[model samples]
Target: MTKEEREQIATCIREEIETLRETVARLEDSAKTVDLDQPIGRLSRMDSLTNQGISGKVLAESKRRLLGLERALANVDDEDFGHCEECGEPIPVRRLLIMPEASLCVDCAE
Candidate 1:
């Protein structure tokens, strides 16, 4: 990839990592604030617990993506940064723009 392209991808990844971190922080705070012993009814507490579970799952996925983005940033200048890991083919720039952390091409991802 060209130097400019690599820089662009790195920027995108960094921005995404920042956004994901903020979201994960917010989710963590929300999870912490969930109170089961409040004056709310049983159904309300159950609903809160269910929402907490969903938020936890989403937070985990976001953190995983954040890690992936950080790895992409670290390898932004690697010779194979934009290549498909499974096929050793060039991953399209458009795809890379959409998913800066992707390591597999569309066909391999399927």
Candidate 2:
């Protein structure tokens, strides 16, 4: 990829990392607000627990994505940043735009 394209992808990845950090912070705050000891109906507690579980999973996924984005940003200037690691083919710019963290072409990923 061209230098401009690599820079663009790096910018996008940084933005995504920032957004995910905000989401993770919010999820952590919400989890902290959950009170199991407070007097509440059993069903309500169950619902709260269920929501907490879902939130935990979402937070985990966000963290994972953040790591990927950070890795992509770190490698943005690499000679083969926009190439498929498996086949050594150029990855489409469109795919890279859509998924700045991707390191493989569609065929290789599949």
Candidate 3:
């Protein structure tokens, strides 16, 4: 991909990471506010905690994706952004368009 296109995708990835961080923080705060000692509170807290756990997991996954995107941006800075790291071949534009964070080409990924 072109440098301009890479920059645009990097910007979008950063924005998405920021949004996910905010959501993760909100879920964590909400989970903490739930009291677990009251009669019905225990059940409610359990449910809330479970939901929070799932959200937290998703957030962790998002963070991983963000890290990958950061690395991709670094690759752009190094002038290797569109090349497969493992094979040193040009990664398809379509794949990069769909997943800007990709480090491996389709063959390597499989």
lDDT of 2 by residue, 51-86 (tens): 999999999999998888898888888887888999
lDDT of 1 by residue, 5-69 (tens): 88888888888988999999999999999977789998989999999999999999999999889
Rank the candidate models, highest lDDT first. Answer: 1, 2, 3
Q: Which of 2 and 3 is ahead in TM-score?
A: 2
lDDT leader: 1
Q: Candidate 2: RMSD over Cα atoms?
A: 1.0
What TM-score does structure 2 among the candidates reach?
Answer: 0.94
| Predicted structure 1, TM vs. truth | 0.94
* Model 3 bad stretches (over 4 Å): 35-40
lDDT of 3 by residue, 42-101 (tens): 667678778877877876786677677676656665667778889989888778766878
Q: Candidate 2: misplaced stretches above 4 Å?
A: none
- The estimated TM-scores of all candidates read 0.94, 0.94, 0.73
Q: Assess the local accuracy of residue 64 in candidate 2 as a C-alpha lDDT between 0 and 100.
A: 90
User: Residue 46 error for model 1, in Å?
Assistant: 1.2
